[model samples]
Target: MTHAPTPAAMATRKPARTAPAWDRHTWEEALLAATLPHHGARLLGWGLAHLAPTSGQFRAGTSRDAGYLGQALRLSAKQLHMGFSQLERAGLLARAGAAATDGPRHVLAQAFTLTLPSATAAARTESDG
Candidate 1:
C-alpha cells in the first residue's frame, strides 16, 4: 500500500518556478529610452538585466571589483566610471561614498532604481515627434 506524504515531506518540497519579473525586451526598451550616452545606456541595461535585484535597486562595485560585469561588458574601469557619471546626470543612477578608485582593492559603490519611466517617456516623445 502507498503511504500518504507526511507534512515534513510536503514542507521540504520546493516551490514551483515562475517567470522572471523582467525580460530582455524590457531591458532593450529601457536602454533605448534612456538619455545617456551609448556606453552609459549599455552599461545600465546590462546591469539591470543581469545583476541581482536587491529591494528594487541594482548596485555596482568598483571597476577593479568589476567581477562578471566588467568582463562581460568589455569596458575598462575608467569607462565604467564615465558611464556611471552619465547615468547619474540623467537621473538613472546614484553613487555613494567616494568615486571609483583605480586601486585594485577598492570598489566604487553605486546604486540605481529599476524603473525608467522618465527615460521611456523621453524616448516616446522623440519617436512621436
Candidate 2:
C-alpha cells in the first residue's frame, strides 16, 4: 500500500477543470428571430425575460392571454397568437391553459412556461457541433 501524498505535493498539482455554464440563450433567440416575423421574436424575448425558476421548470410571470399581451406589446391578438404557435412548435414555449379571471368570453389569453436548455443538454450540443 502507498501512503497519501504530502500537502506540499497536493498543492503543486493542478486544480480540476469544469465545463463552463450554459450561455446559448442569445444565440438560440437570434436563430429564431431570423425565422420569425410579425413581432414573434419580441414576444418570445418578453416571455424569456420574465421567466422565474420554479421546481424543475421556468414559469412565465405573465398569465395574461393573447389579447392583453397584444395590447401591452402593441401587436394584435391574432399576431400574438401566431407568435405563440410558432414558438410552441419550436419547443421554446409550452401553454398550460388560459388565465383564471372573470373576463370577456372572447378573450383567449394563455398561461405559458418557457423551456430553457439544460447545462447537460448544452454540453451535448457543444460536443455534437
Candidate 3:
C-alpha cells in the first residue's frame, strides 16, 4: 500500500518554474547604441523581453503589430512608428505587411524580424590575421 505525502513534504517542494531573463549580446548592444534612437533602443529591449526564452522570437499577438506593442511598452503610437522606422533603417529589423484591400482606410499591420549578426565572420577574421 502507498501512503499520501505529508503536508510538511509538500511544503518542501520546489517553486513554480519561470522563464529565464533575456540577455543582450555585446555586438547587439553596440549596434543599437550606434544606430538606433533612444526610443528605438527601448522598443528593442521590450521586444527582446517578450521573445521566447529558447527561440528568441517574439510571441504571438506581439509580432509585427505596432499598436499592441505600443500599448505593452506604454509608448504612444507615433513614437512606436518612429522607433520602428529607425530600427528598420538600421538593418537590425525587417518588417513585412500587405496593404488593406477592403476599404479606402489603410490599416497598419506588419510583422517584425530581428536580424542578429553571426560571430563566424569575426572568427574568420581572427584566423586570417
Candidate 4:
C-alpha cells in the first residue's frame, strides 16, 4: 500500500501558509491596507475575489446540478455551497429564487459577483476592452 504524504512532505513542495492564523498575520495586513475592516472582512474579501465569476442572483445549481460549482472550483460541491453562503453574508454575493418549479418557487442555487475592492478592480481590468 502506498503511504500517505505527511504534512512535512506537503510543505516541502508548497510553502505558503494556508492556516487561518498564519494567513491572518500575513494577508490580513495586505488586505487591510487595501480595504476597511480587518481579518474576518479580509477573508470574506478574498473569498469574494475568488468567487466573483459565480456571483449573482441567478441559478447556481439545480437539484440535479448540485455539483455544478464543484466542477468549476474543483472543490466538493458542499464546500463550494458553504463558501457561497459565507460570501453572501459578507455582501459579496446576491442570490434569489428562480421561476417556480412545481409548488412554490424553488430557490436558485446562486450566482456570483465581485463587490469587494480588490475583486472589483480585477473584474474591471479583465472585463474592460
Candidate 5:
C-alpha cells in the first residue's frame, strides 16, 4: 500500500518552471534573446529576467554565493564559478562594489551589475573618444 507523502518531502518539492513565450518579435530579437555564448551568460540572463530592469544599460542584484545559486540554477558550484569568471571576462558581469558580509561565514551575497553587450560596446567607444 502507498503511504501518504511526508511533510518534509512536500516542503522540499518545487513546482516546475514554465518557459516564457515570445510575442510577435523579429528574428533578430529572438536570436538576441537566447543565452549568449559565454559560460555564465545564462546566469546573467536569469538575473536580468528575474531581478527586473530588463530595459536600459545595466541590471543590478546581490547574488548569493555559488553553492546557493547553483542549487537554484541546477548547476554545480564549480560550474557557477566558471560561469562567473566567463561573464566577467566577457564584460557582461561585475561586482557592483564589495561582497556583502552579513551572513554565514561572513559570506552572504555579492553585489553585481550585468551589462548588455551594446552598452559595453558603447562604453568602450566613449572611453576611446
Candidate 6:
C-alpha cells in the first residue's frame, strides 16, 4: 500500500534571510562590498597578519580578536567587519575559536591566519607610511 504524505513533510523550506532586499545581494556580499572597495582583499590580509601577533604566538583553535582596523590596514569599524567576512569566504581565513564579550560575543575571538598575497605585502609597506 502507498503511504500518504504527512503535513510536516509537505511544508516547503524557506529561503535564508538576506539584507533589506534593496538588491539581490546577501548580507555577506553586502558586508564585503561595503567594507572593502578598492582594497577589500588588501584590508583582509592585513587583519590576518595582525591577528597572529595579538593572539600571542598563534594558538590553534583560538579566535583572533581584532576590531575594524586590524594592524596597518586603515579601515572603518564597518569596513573591518566586512573585510573579515570576505576573508572567511576567500578561504584565506577561518574560524578557530570563540570568546565572550561584555555586550555580546562577536566572532572575533576565533583563531585565524592570513594567507599572504604578494601584492598585499607590497601594499602594506606602502600604506604603512
Compare the candidates by TM-score and give the number of the best one: 1
lDDT of 2 by residue, 7-65 (tens): 99999999889844433465356435433444554464465444333421344434554
Structure candidate 5, residue pairs in collision: none
- Which is the leading candidate under lDDT? 1
Higher-ranked by TM-score: 3 or 6: 3
Which model is ahead, 4 or 5, in terms of TM-score? Answer: 5
Stretches > 4 Å off in candidate 4: 1-66, 97-114, 117-129
lDDT of 1: 0.55
TM-score of every model?
0.49, 0.43, 0.45, 0.32, 0.41, 0.38
Q: Which scores greater on lDDT, model 2 or model 4?
A: 2
| Each prediction's whole-model lDDT (CA) | 0.55, 0.50, 0.49, 0.41, 0.47, 0.45
Q: Ranking under lDDT, best-scoring first?
A: 1, 2, 3, 5, 6, 4
Taking the tens digit of each residue's C-alpha lDDT, what string does model 5 give over 75-109?
66555655654444444555556543343222224
Give me the overall lDDT of model 6: 0.45
- Give the lowest summed-lDDT range of ten residues in model 1: 103-112
Each candidate's clash count: 1, 3, 1, 8, 0, 5
lDDT tens digits, residue span 7-93, model 4: 889878866676332222333344444423223334444543443333222335544243443454355544545554444444344
Cα miss at 2, model 2 (Å)? 34
In the range 1-129, model 3's lDDT, one tens digit per residue, is 999999999999998999644344643573544434455555645564354344444433454455555566676666665555554455454555532333311113434455443454334323433
Instruction: Estimate candidate 2's alpha-carbon lDDT, on a 0 to 1 scale.
Output: 0.50
Model 4 vs truth, CA RMSD: 14.1
Better of 3 and 4 by lDDT: 3
Q: Candidate 1 lDDT, tens digit per residue, 51-76?
A: 54534455555243454555667766
